[model samples]
Target chain A: MILAPQALLSAQQQIQRDLHSCLDYFDLPHPLKDAVHHAVMLGGKRVRPALVYASAQLDGDVMSAAARRAAVAVELIHCYSLTHDDLPCMDNDELRRGQPTCHVAYGEATALLAGDILQSMAFEVLGSRMFDTADLPNPAIALRQMQLLATASSKMVCGQVLDLQAEGQSIDQSHLENIHRNKTGALIQAAIMLGATTVLPVAHPSFTHLRIFGQSLGLAFQVQDDILDITADTEVLGKTAGKDIQVQKSTYPALLGLDAAQVYAQQLHDQALEALQQVTGNTQPLQDVTQFLLHRQS
Target chain B: MILAPQALLSAQQQIQRDLHSCLDYFDLPHPLKDAVHHAVMLGGKRVRPALVYASAQLDGDVMSAAARRAAVAVELIHCYSLTHDDLPCMDNDELRRGQPTCHVAYGEATALLAGDILQSMAFEVLGSRMFDTADLPNPAIALRQMQLLATASSKMVCGQVLDLQAEGQSIDQSHLENIHRNKTGALIQAAIMLGATTVLPVAHPSFTHLRIFGQSLGLAFQVQDDILDITADTEVLGKTAGKDIQVQKSTYPALLGLDAAQVYAQQLHDQALEALQQVTGNTQPLQDVTQFLLHRQS
Candidate 1:
């Protein structure tokens, strides 16, 4: 059920082009411009953008400019978060994507500004006239997309706050869920919702079904990540491995025991697929994505 | 011609109320909620919100709910910038508005998250349907307003980056102006533009006039701030005084002599007033506000 590697590569390339085009809007100074370019082109797996594309495909419509912009915007937010989270005051990470982190290459101040500018650029892309048609889609849809991105971003930061607060403390299951659901799950759900919203009305039943599917898949995605942190090697992971355990951060395997954690991931993956079954289209891409999340090695 | 104290007070109260109401939308945890509240409620001059109100009034219409929301959004962004700028890795300031900085009150991690959430809330305030009217204004205008905010924010951050880089370096007058224009001028201009967009079309000639006015006033405002850092005392400024010099940072007065800087501020203030001459309606409030900026202390 794995997706064709070519499909993922094409999506990444499309997103990369859209992201690069964002820089053309601003005549940024040379150093800031270079850092912004480096931040976006760090070459991580374009999973969020891929989700946007796969979700858009669910309605049998070709990817429109709106969908492409949303994909790029979500990816920009993801990249911004990674850049900031790796700052010296925060995670203090040195390596990202098998390369030196943004602050390590550009000074801390430039890296901070780069993250801030990247975040602003995300909204600019969503709000601006990125489309080529004479008649644009409903403006309310664009506003709603911005709202979704902002809300998810707020939740993601709040989750990070909670994670930082719980660093040395012994947290329970509900606490762990709160952290992951906000930290990682909110934006994942936002990616799917943003994509679905491009073609589906906010009140559509398909929207609800997709929300549930995204929620389950997002949680599954994080659980699998937690599993990989302990089981995967650094060379395969492409970043530091076992970071969670090293930092004494709680993870699914630590909280639920390794055997039960695997079982839980499988259960969430099945639930995600079940939610997609209610939709009346070819959901094979979504199914393949869910399967991919469940089995991704890095 | 100074703005009536009561008028400024009323606008400040209105903006404060709208900002507080934003918290009602989210049931945050106690600590984070308190920090966010503290960040917003650390009352300052509310000059940005006043500019928003004054600009909206230039069209001879009562302020709409949209205008109120835009005013609050600008203020929230301003607050978020101050919160982040005071972080240990950034300015590392210990006081603001005569208060212990957010990072000082809460931990650095919490303060960082608080700033991030406050920024998200700004967009939420702008994009959400907070109005009582069933018929909303054109969605394109709202999108344009958001774009202005995001662009201004990016420029402001870039300015901060430049400022950080320029510290301890002997910079020229043009470089100093560049830092202030992006760091402080962009958002101030954005506030005026946000208010004007609520009442004026994007293509309206008035928008151009207001942009010039805002740019002039924003730069003048920063020059005055630099002058006050040397001329004013800590108790009157309500923040640390002379910290710019203490940090060995470049300022307008440092690049240009203090007397020439004062003359430059007066010139910019005159330019701001001249831009208002082309505006159609009774621009009394704007005129009074600009006069206040040119002459006020503390």
Candidate 2:
């Protein structure tokens, strides 16, 4: 169920426009405007926002305001996390997506401020639904979205803390899974839920099924990331290859053999598709995204 | 108009309890809980939280759930800012309030994650109105609160960037004011407005006067902070005394003489009280907080 190339391109363009509009509010004279633009506008896979749109693409091609917001917020959160994670005190990385990281492009102080503001802007975008007059959840949906985003963000922070602690330590597989679930899986789950929340009530039966789909897709995504660190070269990875092994970070290939990890990814991908079957909608977009995660090189 | 000792004490205690409850959500087995508790529960003036409670004390001594949430959210934002400000890349200060800074106490990575989590938790507490059934803003007030908090937080981030850029450079009074207005004053303004919005609608006339009051109070607070950096000793300041001079940062005492800065602080304080008089409420609590801000020794 590969996505039509047009669908993916549209989602990318829509997110770009929405992000540009969000930044216009901070368009006054300041270095922050440039720093934020650099941090966000630089290209990445747009996986999180893709999940948000793919999950919510059940309606017509013209996305609703609520869906637009869900799409922007998830991507913003994803962008901010990568910025913070690349700081000198964190991963100390100097490059991302094959270009200079935020701290390298901007000074370290400006980079830190840019990351901080992006986090606030994410919530600001969530609470910016002051003029919705349609059957949108109005403020209620925004509140729910904020709750979901905030909780997942919090869990991601904790997951980073756990991962930091786990480095250089001999932890079991469950411990590693715990870190990935919090650090990576929670936000993926929220992206789908936020999209679903845009069109359906929180109590809808579809949410239960989507949660399972998100969880499986999340693991599949991370397993592929771990696998790529070993098998892919530096240029295709857009980051230094073999960074996990260099830093001695525990990864799926380190835990299981590379061949076994690939099998696990396929298994998780199958599990994700199976869960999507329980959900009532045009789930082809989600299936395409699942396949993308399993097969992406960078 | 000075706040009664018991009133100030009660606000302090209430904020402490609410902050503890907020941290309880992250109470699972992780170092983050301890790092966040260390970042927040450590003693400071609790001035921001006090503003929230005082501004919302129109009806009774016991605060509403809306008031409680406002109080918590502002302080959380304030705490997060301070933590980030103390990072090695930012102010690089090693101590705060006579104790090691977040980065000094915890590792730098943990400290960074703690600050990030606190920011998200502030929004989470704001959107946690699911259990509130009272005439509180239900979710509207929370939405407004989020708007105010997120905007102020964004402004504060820009202000920090501006301040960082202004270091060791010649700047004028208006430029310094712009930095303070966004960095320090925006959040201070938000703290008062959040409290007011808890009890008053966005369209209330009192908000017009309160905004003026908040702007004046914010400037006065920063001016006084600058003055204290020059006149106070190290132990009393709980941070290094005269660090402003050390860093060559733009401050009132540096731009204007210490004597003129003191005079300016008083003038701003008087202007704040004048604006408060126009607001139709028992503004005594707000007045007391204002007086305390003007004359505080630390």
The models' CA-based lDDT, in order, is 0.84, 0.85
lDDT of 2 by residue, B1-298 (tens): 2344667778889898888877775554467788888889997889999999999985456678878887888898898999999999999999899999999988888888888988998888887752256543466777788889999999899888889889999999999999999999999999999998878876999999999999999999999999988888999889989899899999998888989999999999999999999998778888888888898878
**Where in model 1 is the C-alpha error above 4 Å?**
A1-4, A131-138, B1-4, B131-138
Standalone chain B TM-score for every prediction: 0.95, 0.95
**What lDDT does candidate 1 reach at residue B100?**
96
Q: TM-score: which candidate is best?
A: 2
RMSD of each: 2.3, 2.4
Off by over 4 Å in 2: A1-4, A59-61, A129-137, B1-4, B129-137
* lDDT (Cα, tens digit) per residue for candidate 1, span B92-197: 8989988999989997767877887777777877887765357554577677778889888888888887888789999998888898889999999999889888
List model 1 lDDT by residue over A1-298, tens digit each: 2344666768778887877777776677757888888888878778898888888887785998888888888998898889889888788898888888888988776777787777877887887767545555457778888888988988888888788878878899889988989999999999988887787766888888888898888888999999988888988787899888888898889999999999999999899989999875667766766776787788
